[model samples]
Target: MADLSVNFAGISSPNPFWLASGPLTNTGYQVMKAFDMGWGGAVWKTVGEPVINVSSRLAAIDYGGRRMMGLNNIELISDRPIDDNLREIAEVKRRFPHHAVIVSLMLASDPTLWSDMMRRVEDTGADGVELNFGCPHGMSERGMGSVVGQVPEYSQQITAYAKSGSSLPVIVKLTPNVTDVRMPARAAVAGGADALSLINTINSVMGLDVETWLPDPHVADRGSHGGYCGPAVKPIGLYMVSALANDRRVPVPLCGIGGIETWRDAVEYLLLGAGAVQVCTAAMHYGFRIIDDLTEGLNDYLDRKGLASVQDLVGKAKHRVGDWNDLRLSYSYKTVAEIHADQCIGCNLCFVACDDGGHQCIDRLPGQRAPVVRKDDCVGCNLCSLVCPVPGCIEMQDIDLGLVETWRQRQSRVGF
Candidate 1:
């Protein structure tokens, strides 16, 4: 059996799965529930000088019939009192000492505010603090959140301030809105960030209704650009994490964030060099129960792959990545699909589609037997692979188009 336990920056968790700082971690009750549900740790939501959050501060995006798979929010940091948050953090840590109860915080334009907040939160005895430099909406307009992240100088100075104020490890949570991610990343490390967590929600607004002319979850008949997170943000997050991990310029422990709902997503982040993977949107949308799957699923994955621990997977993919020219240009493949006899109902959907909408690649008789794939003419565009009822019924295969440069040479010689 593999040991999933990890000692990250002197903070030990049973695993590398941590709930991110968001709506789900807004309180001790929520954090406790998440811990009970098997999350390795939790970063308490961004707590500021008691905020006055607005009514209906959330908006969403729907694509492919999935609602809130990608979420947007205008919600500010924790609207609760500062002392109350600290009390809860103190109590939660005493009760669940094994779990990493990280305090997340955001505050005003003044250095004194940052200094005071870090000192106050540190008194709670939390394992660490993640400076919220990456909320894309609401707070950004006030010279905080993503606004702070966009300016490298601001990030550097504030990080230095936070480092000065905190006794615990200070993890700078970065925004994705910067021109180049590495620039801000470098600034944070330079200013003394103990660790870096990245890819906070992006700015986005969902489409509007046609007849009503109002965007969904209407906020006084209008809505502002909100922080976007969830499945949609995973790719962007992965790219940022990989870029920083692979870059020799930035050398800080990374806490991977953005759109991770499952263990596979966590594994990918760790393989790309994250010490831990954080969840925000998934917990907001699906509630804290998903942590069970996040933990057990990763355990099963480790067992299957013969991985002895979570650290074994971290940065595994970094070495495999190559420069542009190092990529194999000679390798080529054509799209192909193989139908499963058991899964196929012989609906001829692909046949009709190919006949009318696509190239004449699919074959089916009007009133005949099972629709059969004609390999000779099948271009492997995967149209048939889609519209199939059962998963794996139609498998997409890449057929060799065969030596493209050689074909070009023959054609040139014959002038064909």
Candidate 2:
């Protein structure tokens, strides 16, 4: 059996699935309940100066019968008293000594406040402290949250303050709002961060209600832009995580967040260089019981892959990610769509898609129910495969062109 345990940036946990800082992790009851259900760790909801959150705090986008394909929220940090949060943190850690209990924190820009908060959190006997610089909604307006995360200088300065004030490991949670995520990632590392977690929710406005002529999750007749997250954001999260993972300057363990719902999603993060993964929307959608499947599925996957432990899976695919310029030119390599005729449902969805939206490579013969792929014209865009309802009906077959040259190589050859 593979060992599911992990020691991430000095914070040991029984596994790599930790509940992200959100509504689900807002209380000791919730965190303890989640741990009992098999979660490895929990980052307690961000604690700072308490603020009253508005009603109708959440909005979601559903697609194809999947609820919350993406979730958006105008929610702020924990509204509970700081003293109450601290007491619960100490109690939870004391009870679940082996589990990772990381307290997420945000504060005014004052260095003294950061230093003091760090000391107070450390006294709770928690395994680590995560600087909550990634909340993208209400907190940003207050000069905290993404305000600090967006600027590399502030990221470094605050991380330094947190590190100086406590002996506990400091993990900087980064926002994805910037043009390049690596900037703040490197800054956090430069400030003595033991690890990094990304990406926090994206800046977005969910949608507008046409009937009422109001934005989604409206507070009466008004709505504000909120942080966006969920399965829909998985691709963005993967790109950002891999970007940091492949970079040589940001040398620190990563805790991947955003759009991770299942063991497969968690595995993708691990392979892309995350030491652990954080879940928010999924847990909120499915409940804490989902942890059982998360652990079991991961354990089974590790065993099937012949891996000894979860750590062995981390960064295994890092080398596969590279700049687009490094990709082989089309003349050097290519793939064409191959439609399995026997399996085709004759839906012509592929044909419609290829003709209308993609390259006009798929043709429907007069006498045949299945469409034929004009392989020579097929650009291997995979649009046909995506539109096909049947799995494995359309396969992209690689064609070895007996040549190998990247864009950079071609540029060099042409002396451009």
Candidate 3:
């Protein structure tokens, strides 16, 4: 069997899948239950001075049959007392000795407060600590979350404080609210962080309740922007992870988060250079039992690929990622839309899309039997192929143009 276990920043876990800090890890009971159900690790909900969350703190975006495609939350950190959380952490670690238990911490940027909290949490026997500088809403307003994370200097300073206060490995969780993610990532590494995790939710507002003329999840007919997560944020997370992973300047293990719901998603993150990954919304929507299929599916995939362990797959695709300028301008793949005679229903969607939006490649009228791809006008953009409802009905056939020269080579030959 391929080994799914991973050692992320010196904190060894049974596998790369860890329950991200959120509603899922808010209590010892929940954490323990998740471990029992096979989650390899858990980052305890962000702990700080207790908070009083509002009644309507969560709002979601649903697309037709898909519910919770994107989730927004105005919720704060763990509202439980610090002592109670510490006690639970101690107990959970004692019981699940082999599992990774990382305590997530957040507080004002005061060095003493951060250092003291780090020291106190380290005493709980947890595997490591994740600096919660990524919360984008409630905590940010309080000057504790993305308020500090958005500033590279503040992130570096807080990371230093955590490192100073504890010997335990420190993983700095980053917010995606900034223009450039690499700046903060480099800052965390410079401040002595052993590993990095991202992305904490993006700041967003779900739709407004147009009938009532109020924002969604309104407390009093008005709602504030909140942190957004779920499947919609996966692309953003993958882009940031790939950007950092490809940058050799910022060297630190990454625990990818945001919109990871399955084994395939986990594999994508790992191949993009994440040492491991964390999940929140999936566990929030489904249950911790999702880990069963997540693990089994990943294991099966690795076996089929003849991989010995999950570690072997990490960063496998990192080198393949490149800057836009590095792309091959010379290589050309000209494919034209080909319609299957027997399969065409003459929906005319392809013709309409191509004529109005694409290269006017497909020729069809209201009573036409089928859409024909006009070879000369076809740019091979595949727009017609995409809007077609039936699968295999519209196929893009490649046009083999013999040896080709790149723009760069052609420019050199002209010698401007």
Candidate 4:
């Protein structure tokens, strides 16, 4: 059998699927249930000084009427008292000794406070601590969360404080709001972090209310920018994960978070160099039962691919990622749209779009109500193929260019 287990930063879990720090992990009941449902780990909802969240704390963006395509929230860390969260962590870790229970924490920019909290969490027998420096909204306003995450100095200082206070491994959760994620990633490594988890939500406003001219999730008819998560942020999260994984200065293990909803999504993160992956919104939208699909799909996939374990798949695709300049400029293929006479509905949508927006390569047939691609004028752009209503009716046929050469090599050959 393909082993799905993972050991990220020395904290071994039955599998790489972990519940991210969010509403889903706010209590021990939720964490325990998630473990029972086959999640290998859970980052306990971020704990710190108590916070009072706004009445309307969450809003979402949809695509084609799907719910929660992108979620936005102004909520802060755990609203429960610190002692309560600590006690729950102790209890959950004691009950589920085999599962990875990582404590997520945030605090005011005081090193002493951070260090003290780190000490308290270490006593709970948790596997590790994730510094929650990435919450982007309410907490950032108070000099916590992404405020610290946005500054490399603050990130390093706080990470150092956490490491100094706790013998357990330290994982720094990074925010994506910054211009360059590598800056904070390097700082975390410099401060002795054992691993890094990212990316926290992005800064966003989830559309506006036309009636009041205010943003959605308006509390008392007013609103503020919130942190965005869910499926929409997966690409951004993957990009940041790849960047950190490829950075020489940031060698720590990575726990990928943000918009991971399925086993396939988890595979993409692993192939891009993540040691483990965390999930939130998907579990929020569906239920913790989704872990069934997450684990089963991954296990089946690994077996089919003839891999021994999930670790073998990690970072396999990293080398394939390259800068735009590194791309093969000379690789060329000419594809022309081919129309099937039988499948053509004579809608002429493809013809109209191709004629006006494309290279005007499509022509109406003289006798029939069908259109044909003018092969002489076609540059093989595939505009007609794309706009065609029939699926297999209009398809692009590739014209082999016979050779491939990079622009750099071509320039060198031409003596440029």
Off by over 4 Å in 2: none
lDDT of 1 by residue, 300-324 (tens): 9999999888889989997666455
The runs of at least 3 residues in candidate 4 whose Cα sits more than 4 Å from the true structure, single-residue gaps closed, are 330-402, 408-416
Candidate 2 local lDDT, 324-400, one digit each (tens): 99999888899999999999999999999999999899999998999999999998899999989999999999998
- Overall local distance difference test of candidate 3: 0.90
| lDDT, candidate 2, at 389 | 97
Cα RMSD to the true fold for all candidates: 4.5, 1.0, 2.0, 2.6
| Candidates in descending TM-score order | 2, 3, 4, 1
Tell how far residue 35 is off in model 4, in angstroms: 0.7
**Candidate 4 lDDT tens digits, 249-359:** 988899898899989999999999999999999999999999999999999999999999999999999877756545455245466778888999999998899889988
Candidate 3 residue runs with Cα over 4 Å from true position: 365-368, 397-416
lDDT of 4 at 349: 92
State which candidate, 2 or 4, has the greater TM-score: 2
* lDDT for 332 (candidate 3): 48
Query: How big is the RMSD of model 2?
Result: 1.0
Answer with 1 or 4, whichever has the higher TM-score: 4
Pairs of colliding residues, candidate 3: none
Candidate 4 is scored at a TM of 0.91
Q: After superposition, how far is residue 364 of candidate 4 from its true place, in Å?
A: 4.8
Model 1 scores what on Cα lDDT?
0.82
